[model samples]
Target: MSTVSRAPKRSLASRLPVVHQLQQSVGLQRGMLIAGLVVSGVFVLTAIFAPLIAPFGFAQRRDDAGIFGAQQPPSAEHLFGTTVGGYDVLSRVLWGAQTALFVIVVSVILSIFAGVLLGLVSGYFGGWLDRVLVVVCDAIYAFPSLLLAIVMSIVISGGQSSLVGGVFAAAISITVVFIPQYFRVIRAETVRIKAEAYVESAKVIGASSNRIMFRHVLRNATRTLPLIVTLNSSEAILTLAGLGFLGFGIEPTAAAEWGYDLNRALSDVTSGIWWTALYPGLAIVLVVLGITLVGESLNDLADPRLRGRRAVAQSAGVVAETSVVPGGSLTAGPGGLGGLEDGESFDEHGIETR
Candidate 1:
């Protein structure tokens, strides 16, 4: 009776979207996801352990050995060398990860709550309020996102703000820009889902409007959100970098920021000093590339048309199941199949013979 277990017992945590794909994927898709995961993991760990991992403070010009000379080339003492401001490049890079992480988290959270709520309400109700919201989102989308972010950042905090102020200035500005994107996508999803049979059935059952909206509608509406999240995370990083590069970022003494590092390195480029610009710019590229890879891989896997099934013959020794129905309980008797089918019978060996 136990010969064929029903897909084993996987915890809900283990069945999370990307992790499930990461576990099941094979070939090129698997390779891309692994690479992205490694890079993202490194970025996250560096952010979490910046103070412990870094050799010096982000704004520190001196250490036990004295002041780190400006624009020093790579050496044993400073692996990534020193910036023009006499701070260790490695330390700044590590600490910058923390700042980038903060922006991504804050921006994504704010945007998700505000956008999803508005979309849920607008889509569920669908009246003058819906039309007004749609028009407002369209108007917001009409302006360039970056320009809007810049204006928001300027209004919130000008040059050389404190760490929290600067991070929030950049994050909130990004939130405003992305709210519309999330709203449109979610609103459209909600509209389509509201008419689904399950939703209608829930309504018919006299379930509270709030319960129906949240329990049934919200769960299905957010399936596509993970894809949007990955894309927006990379954009959040870019927006933070842009803010710093344009001189609206945190003060160097207040915190490390990649865009500000790039801004400070511009003069060094003409001087043929490469380390200053290279590492920070490379950090941006690698982080963005990693997020983009994860997003693309998930999107491919999510689309049945793109991630076509592997035939049993092509799967080596593995036999993949297409249907999701599980085998019967032990109470259904020694055979795993629920019961006898029209032309199927269980032989002495307990196998279903047709």
Candidate 2:
């Protein structure tokens, strides 16, 4: 009896559009996705294993005499060479991975929570609150993202060398820039979904506003955020670097950061000390590229129309393959039948003649 009662519920749930979307999410642009995953995975692993992988501590000097020479070219002792400040360029680059990871994680998480919350409220309520919030978001969005980040960094830390302060400054600045984006996405989705038939049904059935917003609308609205987060993560790395380069970033000797490292290397390039600048710059480029690729692939995946097209293509291929047997027999199975009966055709799954 219970099994009988549950079957219809399962069928209804399976038929939901959301279910179809989830089913189609996989194997879209497989090559791009695989490449993104591989590159992003390398950065994540490098950040996680920085301590074990780095040959020397980020600030460790080569000798006990505390007089290590600067600008030493790549050699057996120093693989990538030494910075003008006598720090190992390789070690600093490796440790910088940790800093980059922290900033991305902290900033993205904060932005998502704040932006989603505001977006949900403004979108669902749709009153003065919504109007006011929208205006504010638009105003904030007008500023250049990098410029906004710099201002936020200065306001937060005054450009001091405290690692904690620097991290917070970078993260919070990024959050400010991204919150409006998230808000706009979720708000628009909420507005559309709040009027959805299912939402109306939930309301008619005495479901509370909170329940409808959080339970039904939130999930659908956030489907695009993974893509946004991925793209924003790459942007965050660039912002952090920009801050470091402008002297508003992590302080000298406080921690290893690519931007700060690059700032130190600006004068070296003129004198032919390439290793100091090359490694950190390369790190930024590679990481941003990896993240951008993942985001773009994810954007493609999140589009239901694209997924639906793929599904249709697959279904068409299946039909083409199944209907035309190699021996030119129209049998449902091998040696079963010669042709379909007059005015008969197979159903979509090739079952149940009609």
Candidate 3:
């Protein structure tokens, strides 16, 4: 009896249902995740190793003789070709990744920290504080995020260093956009989880409000946070790019920014020097797409509705295959049969005969 009890069972992976219903519903992990991660990883690595990877410095330019013609198509010598101003477009694009990624990292960290703090506080201590935050978020949300960024940029445009000023401006504006989302999501989740049995039990055990909210409530409610973070990261990237395009983002003097480059090249678009705008635009689109895919995959993975669907499908399949009768009418197999066909009856021999 002891040996039988101690016998090793099949691994969890082997026991898992073959057809994942949630996977079907969400349609996740069908290569979007892999492709997104691979592309995003390449971009991140390029940004990290920009100094070593770029053949030319961000400010480097060739003289007339070596600069070649403007808007030249991609070639072995000048991949992505040279811009109208004789700058290496590929090198600039590579360097711009660093600037773009830097802003993304800083702004996302600040925004997430601020949003999460405000959300936690507002949700846990509802009343005047919640009302005030709601009002503030509503006001911010009313304005277009890009317009708000421009307004903030105007306020800070007093000969300040573009890098420092632009980062500060982007961080603040992105924080405003994100706080409302965080507050709303966290509040809803908190409200639902706060009344759960575990939370009530904790309260009954004399747990403080802070302990209950942070330890028990927040912990249980955070399964959706990774998806939120991924989505917000993409939003931050778009906002930053928009600010750059409007000339309110990283200053023109900052030579390696995709937004700044795009803005500079906008006028030259008429000269058929399309590479200038095209490269940066493509970079922005790819980065945003990658982030979006990652967020979508994470959401699919975390969503219980999808998981439950997958479970149902798997159970149904198992039942269908395992329900076959050996000689007579169909009956439930070892998997604990549920579904049964009409007119099926069990005889005293423990067999079903039509």
**Best model per TM-score:** 1
Candidates in order, TM-scores: namely: 0.85, 0.82, 0.78
Candidate 2's residue-wise lDDT over 1-354, tens digit each? Answer: 354444334566666643433455556466666677788899999999999999888888766656457899998878999998999889999999999999999999999999999999999999999999999999999989989988898898874668888888889998999999999999999998898899999999999989999999999898788778999999999999998898888865777899999999999999988999999999999999988887887677677677577778888878776746467635553223543434455565666564
In terms of lDDT, the best-performing candidate is: 1
Q: Where does candidate 2 stray beyond 4 Å?
A: 1-28, 64-66, 308-354
Tens-place lDDT per residue, model 3, 46-110, is 99999999877776776545655666667887888777666678898898888877777776677
The 10 consecutive residues of candidate 3 with the worst lDDT sum are: 17-26
After TM-score superposition, the amount by which residue 79's alpha carbon in candidate 3 deviates from its true location, in angstroms, is: 1.4
- Give the lDDT of residue 321 in candidate 1: 34
Q: What is the lDDT of residue 189 in candidate 1?
A: 87
CA RMSD for every model?
9.4, 7.7, 6.9
Q: Identify the superior model by TM-score, candidate 1 or candidate 3.
A: 1
Full-model lDDT, candidate 2: 0.86
Please rank every candidate by lDDT, starting with the best.
1, 2, 3
Q: How do these models rank on TM-score, best leading?
A: 1, 2, 3
Clashing pairs in 1: none
Q: Write the per-residue lDDT of candidate 1 for residues 138-214, one digit (tens) a residue.
A: 99989898889999998887654787888888899999999998899889989999999988998888999899778
lDDT (C-alpha, whole model) for all candidates: 0.87, 0.86, 0.73
Instruction: Give residue 348's error in model 2 in angstroms.
Output: 39
What local lDDT score does residue 75 receive in model 3, on the 0 to 100 scale? 81
